[model samples]
Target: MARRSLPSLRPTWRRRLTLALRGIGVLFVLGLIGLIVAVYIQKAQLPSFDELKSSPNGQMIRVHAADGTVIVSIGPSYGEWLPYDRIPAVMRDAMVAVEDRRFRSHIGVDPIGMMRAVKLAVANHGNEKRFQGASTITQQVARTIFLSNKYDLGRKSREALIALAMERKFSKDQILELYLNKVYFGGGAYGIDAASRKFFGHGADHLTLSEAAVIAGLVKAPSHYSPTADADAAVGRAGVVIQLMVETGKITPAQAASADLKRVALAPEPKQNSVRYFTDWALPQLDTLIDESSRPLEVWTTLDLNMQRAADAAIRANAPAGAQGALVSIDRDGAVRAMVGGTDYVTSNYNRATKAARQPGSSFKLFVYLAALEAGRKPEDTEVDEPITINGWTPHNDSRHNSGTMTLRTAFAYSVNTVAAKLGQQVGFGTVADMARRFGITTPINTYPSMVLGTSDVHLIDMTRAFASVGNKGVAVTPYGITKVTANGDTIYEMQVDRSHVLVAPYVAAQMTDLLQTAVNTGTGKAAQIGRPVAGKTGTTSSNKDGWFLGFSSGLTTGVWMGRDDAKPIPGLHGGTAPARAFAAFMKPATANRPIEPFETQVTLPEFQLEPDQEFGQPDNGGFVDENGNPIDQSAQPPTDQGDEGAQVDGDGNPLPPAGDGRVAKPEKLDQDWMDRVLGRDTPRNQPAPGRSPQRDRPAAAPPPERPADRFQDSRPTQ
Candidate 1:
């Protein structure tokens, strides 16, 4: 029967099909050879393992100014290195469960996983972009190390080959470590180490399952899943990761549900730089300051709401284009009252007040003066103001008129550089540096003669605290912002004032204060005078690269700085100009209702005889005067000199008729009640959760009384 069939075996259709099959097989073999050769060539060009480990990423660390107010967040984290053993097991489980369910059974590349990915891609109408990736953890490691994010066959073939090599060369744990360390987690972070610290103020090893899930979810698209950039999207992505984890039995359904309810809800955060700067500074301390298992925090700060408003307004109104401004204020008790870390939070979140270390110019002269006073030199003592060289670095005075021999008082008033240099030399550079350190200059000091002219860099908060010693009658203060911190409404930590020892002798501080008072009262810092007893020094760097005004009243010490973020010089900018003026503006509004008080001096001031002189040195010659020297109308009640009254006072201080529709300016108390509400003093029983902005009410904010000269003149300086 077989011999009979063999005669018909060579039918036309069968012969043709056989030839076609042979030709197709030959083409397929040739194509496979070409692909292998192409892959080898591409793999040779791919980066080695060392190079891919250094790629950049987004990492965010936030700062806050007030309680429950996020001020700023630092970004672009340079990833912190962490070892495999240091990583939490749960964190590893979360990542593996969501990223590679077959991670344990795979040999570099997973055929089963690839088929699954292909199936999903087909379901999505062949859109590979939406396809679930089949890349094993080992494959990901290879791609991350050796390939760009391109969707091409050559890259894919090489990636698989490299992954197979990696699997042969390293253990499973090693591959996992490599992947975890190199993966990008958004907010300027790379690696699990940086991601954990950037978002939770801790290391990867300590991450909870929920936080780990979020980090694992971020591997797909960092920008879309960035908590600060888009909280809802980030949380939604985390939910998907959790779903995968649960489906794989890596985590219990209850665990996934709990993480979704708690972890995802914690993603959203505020972005303003002013409050963020403080929060960023305080966040890390929470781990040390409170129990690790505490719930979400409600950190209270020593930020006076009124003063915070003043600082914010001053920076925005006075900083020039291309120049950012920062202001920090503290009370004698070392409580930070207010701070402005940046001018426009939206433009740049870099906190000049907290992070920048710029030359303070003449503002740092207080330390030099303090050193001089402590060395037994009086304010009236004389020093030569001639030009001098320090290690061949010549230093010059701001003006020719400032040259020549002058009193220490005069030198300080004009912010004369030569005299400060002379003092630094005489008193010793080490002495000056030590004194500055004692007075709260936390930034490392460059103990050179130029340091006398404020050539050294220091943070604004520390610099403000230095002057606060003058305000506190020589008592050194440790500037602090966090007053209390609660976790999920439970008390966790509280701040205790550490102002104790006198950093400077009372007489020395008094003499220094007298010298600085001359600066604000009549010299370089004259624009900073707030119609009250206040003293400060003006500092303008060489070529006006930086301008600073550090001053203090009896109740508050404040420092202001203005300069370009790039440290470029600003045209026509001076410490005595806008910076000083801004200080005055902030104080005028901030100190409205508080009774004027006198700073502690070596000797009791004459006008401050009774009740410890709450007159701000406004002589007891019986009346108060405005900044323009206009006599203050101090009648407790409304004035009765109404000329058919409808209007009270004109654009000027002169009384206008009642029919006069011209708006009048009158000083009023700051609405502290509204401030209390903001600081979480008395929350309404029916308000939103903590950190959400509540409906506000302001009943006390009032306009400044107009001066008679302001009526017809455009005297206001451009901000």
Candidate 2:
């Protein structure tokens, strides 16, 4: 029975094979449909040259300095693209030889080249990660148009299908032209023509064989082999491309041997020098000016390249070793002219100028003084010299010596610690802090007694903005770096000065400027004085930790800070030292040609008044007196006033007699009325009285009694 069943099993096998074939056929049809849909999706996303040309956002992104000098850029303009006929044959051959030797023979994708790349990748065991990229010119063009600057399997698959479609649609020459025009050569250049001009200062047609090879070599990794970015790597890679050209017979062996892989001298392009400092500060404001988009826009900033270079140089030259510093300069229009984040931008990307929060040292004193000025205090007002304790903290003068008494002008000029502290106390710490915030210092200030000592933290940018306001004549101008932004010739964003009245009166700013000018001319900021009119202040933190010079001319205001990134004390360095030196050096040249316009000082003071007690009183004979008003000779009397004893006086108002041990006796306490009359309560202690003898009450001499008779007798006998 089993043998009989076996004969029918053959038919069952035929049915099973038929069913399997049907299933395979169905799957194949589904895969074809899916492939067609993917092709349609990719084609829909592919951008044509017409689309690129007509796109409203195709304009290049340009960054300009305050003076309208282009510093950096992205994207390409019409002037950057070139026609195929403009390309040199050597460059065209070199690119084809190195990237795809059989470029003309292949339809779009080079299967042989892909297989070779795969072989090399396998031989290297993935250790040489970047050994393979076998995309042909067509595939590369497709990727550039439809994908991002990233490597992935998804991109590779899309690139393959696009290459096939491109071959069916366009000629080999057209594909090659698009590829040359579309590939990125880094350094902000996007095509062979732009790359040639950027790296060699010449057009593609004029590129030498060696230069052409270098450009072609960059197709693999533009940043890695960019002549401006890395010269040695670029030259090394160029040598490989030249060798490939020789092996492919595109270039003669002799030509390859003669070719020197000379590094092409790149033409100067815009460079971003810690621009993040300014951009980060300007970005938030930019949002209000323009809508967000990936479209390229041109942002015209108020930065002056020369001034920015000068400011950067000053910060670098004066910044402490292993330390970071920041500098910001703004013009009278509240436009930021220059900004520097640190010494070397390439070493550290951290922008210290706008982001770092640091105690401004005495630079913060400006705000305190501004507060006092607003509170109806005159620069010439006299303040007492004495120890003042506020909030359990004692603020000492920079000199650490009691001034005894000083005018507000002198106090601020010398940065007298005691005077500023007292003034801050007079105008409430909260008031001073609030005034500072209104002036652009956003950081919270400690309301302690030391706040007047600039114990509060602030960024250099904010500090510069505050100082710039003074130059703006009492208007607190919100500093803006970017002036305007445009996309495809349409105005998208415009920056205008947004200012507020922080000072009580515009004339008050002028008065403060006068005081600051005095500081530059003959005070602590003497080192910062330039030939032109300059007004500024010097600030040195306790223990010489931070040095700062914040000053301004008629047109520009800048603040500089130098200190260790860790806030460690720098020995023997103060604001008036290196920081001021750098500021003056920069300001001298920057303002040399400008006119010397003095800041307006409207408030005037009357001549200083003299107190009665400060005048000399009538001369009295030098004589000791008793409590009963009896005069006593110094020879017959002992000293009256002893160590640590109060001044002793007799009823006659003369010094009292001393005791037997030669120690002066302590005088009894005088009545309040007597002290008031004698000390001249309303007058200073050093004034002189009218018609008083300048020299009186000094010690008198003993009388000469007689000469020796023996001396006279001896002279007569000799004669």
Candidate 3:
């Protein structure tokens, strides 16, 4: 039977061929139907130009100065985004020449191009990863708008289908324009227009042929070929684009050669704001004015660039070796104009202006004087200068010698330690601390007796803020940085001033200002005195551990502090020497253009009066007087002398009577008595008496104490 069938095998082959042709025909019809459905679905999902325009999902980050100079940028948002007519002809030709030479001839997909790419990729044994990108211009646009950075077969397939849909809906020119506007160009630039400004500080229309080639090269690997990111790589890629242009006859060989010689002129890296000090102080206040999600903030700060530079230079110039310093300047409206966190930010990141905790020294005396004035005490009120011990603690003046009598104003102007301490004691310690807190001190203050001497710690920012209150005329206004924030021309935030509370009466603040003026004119803060009217205080910590000068004029208030990070005492440095000098240097140039305004004098009411001068020698009731007007005991006792026994005196220096009875008793030896007094107990068995060596004799006293060896043994035993 098989031999019989073999005789007609040729005819059987024909029958099989007919059946296979029918199967192929049926499959081709189904494939056509499926492709039509796919095309319809893809077109339905495609975004329209109007939809893209109204989408809020995209955002642009732009930074501008107060005067509208663009400082920096981060993202993109907008349709009709391209200056289409303004695009350079060279750039347009180069892009098509390098990316898609036959872009005008293809219908979003090129079978010939795909075949060539497949052949090259196979020839390289899969090692040449970038053998070819067979995608048409339309396909590239689809990938840029809808695909992710991930490289996978599924994404490529989706991009191809989308490109087919786009080719059917838009013209070749429209597709090319969208592709150019949608691609990334690194350096935080998202389009050709943005890239032009980022790399050349110009618009797309003005880009040179070489620059256009460089930008077109970045489409394959933006970061790798970005001029700012990698100049050498970008130049090499640009050379390839130029060669492609030459091969395509878009540019002559001479033009390509000249283009190769052109170098990339990238804009400089943007300058950092360097406003850390002011930002830290203003952060919380800004939070209250705007929500956290606000974008493109237009922070119309009070910062004057000139003043900030002057302050920074002055701080560096006046800062001593191995010492750090901070300066903050605010206006009368409580707006911070300038701030420097330290002498060198690169050396240390610690923000001394808002974070360093140190003693305020004599500057704290201002609070004491303010409290005294509020309690009906006049600056002219006289107080006697005598050592007065309170609860076993005695404070002394810096001179170690007190004036017999002085006015309150003179005492404060001289920063008399004893007088300030005495006045602080008279007013409650709690009262002074409360006053400081009201003036913006947020640090914890210990109400110990030493608080009178500024033993409390405070940040320089808080100190500067408190001093600004004086200039604000008793109204304490919080400082802020960001003024308003808008995104895509929509206002999202507007800064508002948050005035919390009234700290003091206007007249009281003015009186304090008047007293502080005397400090600048004749006291320790004399170095801070400028041509303009100013009031301020100078501070020097114990052993010169810290130096500070804080002052305010009618328009500006400033604080300066200098010290070492280790808290070690600085040599030959004081508040007046370094900090005051810096303050004056900064203020002189900062206030040069402002009007010279004087501090207002304190208003006197009918309740106040001036007392007549009393006789100097008279025991006055109005002035400070102790139980007796003679004098107060203000002496420390010295150690008594020990004399030997059998000592006698001649007639010229004769021995006197023990009392008025004229009894000339023999002088007793003082060795045992002196030893007992010095030791405050019986002498030890091994100890010697006065004028007697231990080797010669042992005094009659208790035996020396002993310790147990076991109790003194090391806690950790050796292995």
Candidate 4:
């Protein structure tokens, strides 16, 4: 009785429908209020419209060579900022036709485009990969200026709110200006002007219809459809943009047909990207020179395009198979004229010139000799070139046998390891290391006896710079690339020429130059001789893992390195064989523009007379001596080819017989260095040759050549 019959609890269908509709309507109102609040919050977090208007579009750094050739353009590249009226009408129409057809009628966000995007997303089962975007040009401008490319409901809402705010504050023309000036178009280009110049080699103000369409098509996927990356895809995308323009009444059918799709050529790209290595090294220095700015900068560097081209050609021509090579050239004032980091930049951009630190091998002896000379040792002073042991370590000459006692000049010119070791020990290893530091070697150097033979690793650029100091006549120079920097036609920084920094006494530098010249003229670095005058030393590491040739001529200093990236041995790879050859080849052309200049100091080399028993063992005779100067048992040794040791080769690395090899067709000598003396190269000298008796006043044959002594043949520690 208390429960009384419950009245009919079920409502009629019409009533149920009305209740449901009311609930739905309430939820919709709440959602709308929440959306409005979220949008207000997003807009509040964004920059003000005035702040956006004053912000710079982007920052670009254009690096130019000494001759005004563009080496590289770093960062996001922006062109001249044009007003709405200055922009080509064809470009504006193309952008509207392809990006947002209802751009003029919509209030920042287009409802129809959103609905279509939603339908398409649902059809694709919410696949983010295949989802199409619905943002208008206004939304893109807001995102580019105020947001990252994060995809989420919160970001989309903020974008829309920002777009709405922008449209309310600025007119349609202003929005278009912002969009065209701030949008990215791949290839590091930002803004319509930059994009046009990047693809068509012209400014946006001079855009053709087809060119405008090509740029407009890049809005969807800048990188994928970039003309420089994929030309066919770029053309196809441009075709689609043209079709859309025709359908949107921006162009006629006949105009679309005559769009010249095939003629949409891209601006020529740099032939080689190796210049990037130089730019990468030079860009970091800008921070120390000037404060960060939004305006574009023009950096005038010390690079010589012609020298760079010559260096590249030399490396390509001389690098052995299965090996990589790097080169660096600097002027007397320490300006980097050219730098080749590796055989090819695309395959590997490790920047071996500035980054890779490898053992300098015998080339390290430069510091040893310099220390000795500064320590009161004279070139005429004699050192016994016999076997030497230091701290249980033994060093050998490239030929493995001693050349007996010789002048300090002769030992240095020969790159004799024992003499260098003795010199280092006498002058103190720490003193040698100090000398290296004074010469611009920044890497850590071990203060050990082995360091005298170049056991420590160093950068090619640093080594080249050290020689540049010598070339500067004992002046200490900091290797520099950027000489001046300008921003918006205003000078921000200019390199000051300071020549008062001296590293050594002029006499000491002159002596070192004399020794290095002898090395090139009559000793280990004979292959590097350039006919006029060059002073340098060659280095061949233990097991032939690395080869080096560092020299200076005509006020330009250069260093060459050849090796494998893995630090493995290259068979029969001596510094004189390839590295010195490359040096000569590059220097011949690089120094052609520079006038011939003689070294400040010159010295008379002492004559070294060899007894019949001490003669350099002919390649055919059984007169060879072992590492200890003992006669070798030719009977126990394996037989080898009987070709002349002085065989020559053409530019193609093909070998040619010696002049007197008895071959009917003797190939002409490629060069006339000491190596040619083995084939009896004859030249008239006022005085007798070094190895000959002081008797005749006429031309005489050079004495027998030493066994390929221009090498760091091997190194080992006895147990």
Each model's TM-score? Answer: 0.51, 0.69, 0.66, 0.74
Q: lDDT of candidate 2?
A: 0.66
lDDT of 2 by residue, 418-504 (tens): 777788889998998998888888877778767776777788888888888887788876777788888766878777565555544
lDDT at 515 for candidate 1? 77
Clashes of 3: 0
| Residue-by-residue lDDT tens digits, candidate 3, 1-719 | 55544443568778899999999998898887876678768878888864542442234544433345443343453223664566787888878988899898987877787787668667766574644557777778887777765555577678778888888777787777776776677765766877888788777878888999988999888888888888888888889999999998899999988775355677786554445455545544545665644243444455666887899899999898989999988776666778888876655657888789988777877788878777777766766666766665565544334555766765655566666768878887888899889888999887765676677889887888888887777788565445566754667776567665778888778778877776664345656756567788877765567888888875688999888988887764566667877998899998888887867752111111112111111101101112121222224412111000001121111233442443333232213333243223354545664445564342445321211111011112111
lDDT of 4 by residue, 403-512 (tens): 67888887777676788889999999999999999989999998867778777889999998888888778898778989999998899999986889888888888888
Output the lDDT of residue 373, model 2: 90
Runs with alpha carbons beyond 4 Å of true place in candidate 1:
1-273, 387-394, 401-405, 600-719
- Residue 99, model 2: Cα distance from true site in angstroms: 3.1
Write down the lDDT that model 3 would get. Answer: 0.65
Best by lDDT: 4
Per-model clash counts, in order, read 24, 20, 0, 0
How many angstroms is residue 440 displaced in model 2 relative to the true structure, after the best TM-score fit? 1.4
Number of the top TM-score candidate: 4
Ranking by TM-score: 4, 2, 3, 1
Q: Each candidate: what lDDT?
A: 0.65, 0.66, 0.65, 0.76
In model 2, where is the ten-residue run with the lowest total lDDT? 710-719
